[model samples]
Target: MTKMMKAVVKSKKAKGAELQEVPVPECGAQEVLIKVKATSICGTDVHIYAWDEWSQSRVKPPYIFGHEFSGEVVETGDLVHNIQVGDHVSAETHIVCGHCAQCMTGNAHICQETQIIGVDRDGCFAEYISLPAQNIWKNDPSLSWDRASVQEPLGNAVHTVLAGEVSGKTVAVIGCGPIGLMAVSVAKASGASRIFAFDLNDYRLNLAEKMGATDTIHSMHADPLEVVRKETNNAGVDVVCEMSGHPVAMDQGFKMVTNGGRVSILSLPVRPVEIDVTNDIVFKGVTVQGITGRKMFQTWQQTAGLLSSGQVDVDPIITHHFDLADFEKGFNLMLKGECGKVVLHP
Candidate 1:
């Protein structure tokens, strides 16, 4: 008989999920089976849980849906090498075709044929998961499971904040979600002269300060563009890391970024956002980059170095924890935006 495990599954094409017993995934020839230790809720996971328009368009039901996790290798397939059973690991999540044009050019994160672990196949929400060996990221033995699980998103933060030259530059992070909070620290670690964080949530703003935001703006109460402009002597910020998918925030980021500066957007807007291309891009001479997942091994290497060297600390951002069975409580916190990163143990 096949082994079974409990997992949070999007068992239907509707809002909400079910924690059910399902057959444990089998390890493929080039894959490894992991005993999940900790997994964290991401905004993407929340979208899938709510069955929003994006989820409806992209996600198929009756599948396990979580990607950010850390685990111990319990078994490995015959073709798997280097990584052995008992290895502590987290996964990169984005599995790419090595022969794709993007992959051939060191852009595997955006490969033409990319299959995300949770979104494209079975994921680590269960007690065990089978993942391709190439996706497995060996963790530092000393890193806590909570922190290890977050490396995936943290890499997103690192890639966005470090996409351009941030050293000795002023940066404005226009969002205080988990990734934005992580960017605050990444900016600080990268030697930003000053860092400003904007968010409607006072809770997250406070958390941003702890994560090394030189200043925090409550977007609901204050105007971020006006405030950042005044604070920067009316020239505007040198770099804008737009992590909020809100159209208003995106507009504010474009408006607050100085002419000829860089803007790195990591957010996914649910709907179309209008911006004056002539003013926001063409005339201003601003460099705009649409950032996606971590930059394959480059971003992963940086993530590991930053985490292991103690240059970045994600412990403060992990605000809540729950067993997989109590996922609803965790989802409730996420829905209200009252928590930072919520970790789940299977």
Candidate 2:
């Protein structure tokens, strides 16, 4: 195996990711080395490239930053089990402390001691990445590497869509980014009666429609709440999946959910927003769930099942592709909303 690998490294405070040669990561005693086949740029990566407040505060430089990916196992540790070299796979990005209180209570997804692969450690935007063997997930050969790499975000969509019963329920996804668009597909596959998508980007709104949204609202030109209310007889949607972390969008999400409905918040609001808690949650009887990462292995299995069954088709969301050398261009496209899920091959 080569001792060095090509990777995109954020070596210092910068405005773009730099393509650099870095040493290939080796497997730990309980980890595995994966030969990455494909990886996708995420919103967090965009933040990292821009050196935004969140990125500056959380991400240290000289680290590789990407979490959504899939690859083949090239090496395994002594204590690893049930995995073989050449097996197609994707692993959970969150490396949770198995001894944490949350983990002991069957809520590893919220382990306070969690360290994300790409965010807190080296990620897969390179030729190879090493991860805890227990974090690895075997993939069905029928799944494409590009699609497999997306399971990380796709699992987030699944977690939101399935937090409540979507079967035959009208759903509205606020913020039609990649994850919101994925939620539209998941809601439809899970038997939603209708799916309404809201987004500021026309390109993303169009992609949402293609991904099975029954209606698309270009929030830049329309009042999303008005449109969704009209569509749902002004009763609001049965479920609201908020993927855009914009405060205004989050406010609209609360207003768009029907009385007694559930609002699954998958977006992270950067600041505290004013809201009438009594009116929004108490009076409306809204159940708000603050979503984190994937539900560890459970979400992964369900996401894989959805992919393997061909129920959630996400091909429409992959609008651009590039080799590792053009990562800046890829991130720029994402920032401009010119692409959906951009795939990068190393």
Candidate 3:
């Protein structure tokens, strides 16, 4: 008989998922079977749970769907080397096709045939998941499961905040989601002179404060552009890290950045957002970048170093934990935006 494990499955073409028994996946020749110890909720997971427009278009039902996780390798495939059972690990969630032009040119994060683990394949919201050995990132033995699980998202924060010069510069992080909060901590750890965090949610703003944001602004209650000018003395921020997918907030980021400033955008707006290219971009000479997943192994290396050296603390950001069976409670809190990173123990 095939081994069975309890997993939260998106069994319907609608909102919500079901706790069901799924057959343990077969480990491929280049893959390793991980006994998942901890997994975390991502904004993408929320979108899928809500069955939003993006989820509706991208996800297929009846599959396990989550990506951020840490586990011990329980089994290694026949062809696998350099990875062995008992290694504590998390993975780079993007599985890229190596022959693509982007992959060949050191930009595999934007590979033409990139497939996300949770979005394009069976994910980690289960007791066991098999992943390609090439993608495994070994964790420090002393790192907590929850913290290790979050390294994937933390890599995202590291990539966005460090993409440009941040040290001794005024910076703005426009979003207080978990990743946004991580960006705040990253900016502070990176020696940014001042960090402003903007969000409409008071709960998240508070979390941002604990994450090392020099100032937290409730965007709905105050004018972000006006405040940016007042704080920077009309020069505007030197760097803007855009994590809010809202068009209005994103536009404000563009406007609040100083001439020749760098704006690295990591958020995926649900639809195309219109912005004034002539004034906010061209004339001002703003450098706009569309950030995607972590930069393969480079981001992972930075993330591990930061976590291991105590350069950044993620304890405040990981605010909730639940058992695998209690996944619904975590999702409920995520939908309300009342909590930070929610980790699920399997």
RMSD of each: 0.8, 1.3, 0.8
Where's the lowest-lDDT run of ten residues in candidate 1?
Answer: 220-229
Candidate lDDT scores, in order, read 0.93, 0.89, 0.94
- For candidate 3, what's the RMSD? 0.8
Regions of model 3 farther than 4 Å from truth = none
Clashing pairs in 2: none
lDDT tens digits by residue: candidate 3, 1-346:
9999989998898999988999999999999999999999999999999998889989998799999999999999999999989999999999999998999999999999988988999999999999999889998889999999999999999999999899999999999999999999999999999999999999999999998998999998999999999999999999999998999999999999999999999998888899999999999999999899999889999999998889899999899999999999999999998999999998
TM-score of each: 0.99, 0.97, 0.99
**Judged by lDDT against the true structure, how good is candidate 2?**
0.89
| TM match of model 3 to true structure | 0.99
Better of 2 and 3 by lDDT: 3
